[model samples]
Target: MWYQVFLWALFSSMFVHIIAALIAFCRLRKHKIGAAVAGLYRAADFEMMPFYALVWGVGQSIIVSFVSFTRILATL
Candidate 1:
């Protein structure tokens, strides 16, 4: 249960970060990023670490799968 709670908090933070990034990316056009906006961008960038861990920890296979999927979907 302890580990479960920990994972829950961890995943929550990760999800929040992803949501924040989407918001920042969406807002980047209209607003100039001052200190606070910069802070939000920085936070979204920092979220990559936890996001990577959460996703990669699921499995290497999934990571590879996703890379391919993203390339195909985004055509990037």
Candidate 2:
């Protein structure tokens, strides 16, 4: 039971991160932020330790995604 719960949580987090990364990339492309920054952000996301990623990464990713969402809505 405990193992199942852990696996579920892990799966959910991975899904969230994948979505967040997609949003971040879309935002970057829309703004033309340059390949260097885009590459750096990608590197950072991958290099981030799992523990810290689980704790703080979600918040950061969500914030970026939220800002992108609002910006898109604002233009319309």
Candidate 3:
């Protein structure tokens, strides 16, 4: 279950990141010089995706645990 949660969080964050990148790229592409500059920065940005995924997954796990604990408490 924890593994599944981790995968879900990772994939969801990645999906969101990709969509955001596409939007930013499209907007930046209007100017050749700007796009080139953004492309350079985006390379470094992409490299941090795994770190983003890890943080997102851990946050999600914490929320899930909190909710589960609350439910158990309510039942008692």
Candidate 4:
């Protein structure tokens, strides 16, 4: 059933996008990694810290929110 679930178009697309974004966010940061990677801009300078804003303190929340919405719509 889990394998069958992975085959759906919606799941595949959203998962691909999520994975890509996560990779990108990781590449952009050096000191810490968290939900905020989504929001990082070129202007930002690296400042190593122990923690980050939770639940997408970075720009990632927007992408995650969109993906979540799509999942909800697909279930309907």
Per-prediction TM-score = 0.39, 0.42, 0.41, 0.31
lDDT of 2 by residue, 1-76 (tens): 9999999999999999999999988877767557776588798886766887687878898988998978976777
lDDT of 2: 0.84
Return the lDDT, model 1, position 37. Answer: 64
lDDT of each: 0.80, 0.84, 0.87, 0.68
Query: By TM-score, is 1 or 3 better?
Result: 3
The numbered model that scores best in TM-score is: 2
Ordered from best to worst TM-score, the candidate numbers read 2, 3, 1, 4
Across 1-76, the per-residue lDDT of candidate 4 in tens digits comes to 8777767977889999999999887766653643365346423765545365454365597887887978976777
Q: What's model 3's overall lDDT?
A: 0.87
Candidate 2: give the clashing pairs. none
Query: By lDDT, who's the top model here?
Result: 3
Off by over 4 Å in 1: 32-76
Q: Give the clash count for model 2.
A: 0
lDDT of 3 by residue, 10-62 (tens): 99999999999999888877988897876987986756568887997999999
* Model 1 residue 16 CA deviation in Å: 1.0
